[model samples]
Target: MKSPYSAKIVQPDISLSICGYSKVLEIVSNKWTALVVYAMEDGVIRYGEIRRRIEGISKKMLTQTLRQLERNGLVKRVITPSVPPIVEYSLTRLGESLLGPMRVLNQWTKENYSLVEQARASYDQAYYEE
Candidate 1:
């Protein structure tokens, strides 16, 4: 059927099966999502707290990440009427459940960091040396 704008792009059956994986990649593969997941590991945190704990993140990026996380139902935004306003973010049950995979990824990264460093050093020494 014809819609308003552009034609559709069709794919093979195998490609269709990969859509689930693609969604997972889209959500968790992001830079800030990982950080937000790790931050929520301990418990709930206010918006400002999430910002403060994870450094080098501008307000725009922080807002974007939070929205993405919320969209995926991996995080919840709580707002309470208070002086100067109060907003907080916390993982939902679904988000909390992701702790296992997220933590595994974190552990793997930490454990393999030394190997990665060594590999980078070796590569530099072999190819980048004067």
Candidate 2:
């Protein structure tokens, strides 16, 4: 009954080893992080453009999200010397690597949105209506 994949798994010492994945999840799982990443998918974009594209994201939230992404090395920030300094944000290679999986997830959400709405309606009728 031994699992074939068990040999491939490395057991970590819980006391000493930290889960790096949870840290990544914490970064991407923020309310506007994924949207910000998606907004930058089409090459370098200016701050105002990102704000305009992602409707309803407050200035504060977008700024914080970009800072976190930059801190995580997933985003690159470029500053141009001009009368008014121009700032642009673009995805790093690491950020680009996440695009495929993010796109898949986005597709799944688009495909399943109606099913999810139906499920929510059914649940509400079953619980709230009674």
Candidate 3:
């Protein structure tokens, strides 16, 4: 199937813009980055809560992902004064901008996942099954 935007997508401007797009993809394409960002979509959340929300993510992995996101200016980390020093995370304006694209992709997956599974099965049967 041909995309409606294929003509525009193939233009020189797209080549010029790919460098910036690649950088964004490098950050967001990390296995845990999108999950961590989604966890804080509603509002400010603490470290433990984000960990709890994403099942099977290790403490170290979550911490590393959070730090990377903060470094990229996509997440804001605030430390509150307390005996234990509570740390909270929320999306910066740049991070909040990602929600729309993510939600659209999520919807696209829901609609097309069955087709993907069927294609994978066909490919496996052709090559892997012998």
Candidate 4:
């Protein structure tokens, strides 16, 4: 089964010119990054909370995403003094700046979700439904 990624091409010039796109490609390109961001959208959340909210994200992946997002200035890491040291992840003001585009993305997904499901159903029916 050839997948869409098999057709995904790397464009050097465009990748270089568009810093915003490059930033997205650099940070959110990871499978778990957007999900992690979405998880933190409501408010500041902890590691365990985020991990539980987003299913199937391994500890390593979540850790790496958090670090990358932190490095990208989109997320801030807070460590508290507690019985066992509490760590929380929150979006920085810079991260808050992404709200508009993220909201737009969410709206687009919501609006087109049914269409995607239909496409997937048709594709699955054609390919593997037998």
Q: Which one wins on TM-score?
A: 3
On the 0 to 100 scale, the lDDT of residue 43 in model 1 is 84
What TM-score goes with each of the models? 0.77, 0.80, 0.84, 0.72
Candidate 2's residue-wise lDDT over 1-130, tens digit each?
9987677647644532367766667778887988999999999999999999998999999999999999989999999999899999999999999899889989999999899999999999999996
Ranking by lDDT: 3, 2, 4, 1
| Residue-level lDDT tens digits of model 1 in 22-123 | 768877887888888888878889988888889888899989999998999999998999997798889999999989988888799999989999999999
Q: What is the descending TM-score order?
A: 3, 2, 1, 4
On lDDT, the candidate that comes out on top is 3
Clashing residue pairs, candidate 4? none
Which stretches of candidate 1 lie above 4 Å from their native place? 1-20
Off by over 4 Å in 3: 1-18
Better of 1 and 4 by TM-score: 1
Any idea what lDDT model 2 has?
A: 0.90
Q: What is the lDDT of residue 6 in candidate 1?
A: 75
**Clashing residue pairs, backbone N/CA/C < 3 A, model 1:** none
Q: What is the TM-score (0 to 1) of candidate 3?
A: 0.84
Candidate 2 residue-wise lDDT at 52: 98
Model 2 error, position 44 (Å): 0.9
RMSD of each: 9.2, 4.9, 4.7, 7.3
Candidate 3 local lDDT, 13-77, one digit each (tens):
55535688776788899889989999999989999999999999999999999999999999999
Instruction: Tally clashing residue pairs in candidate 4.
Output: 0
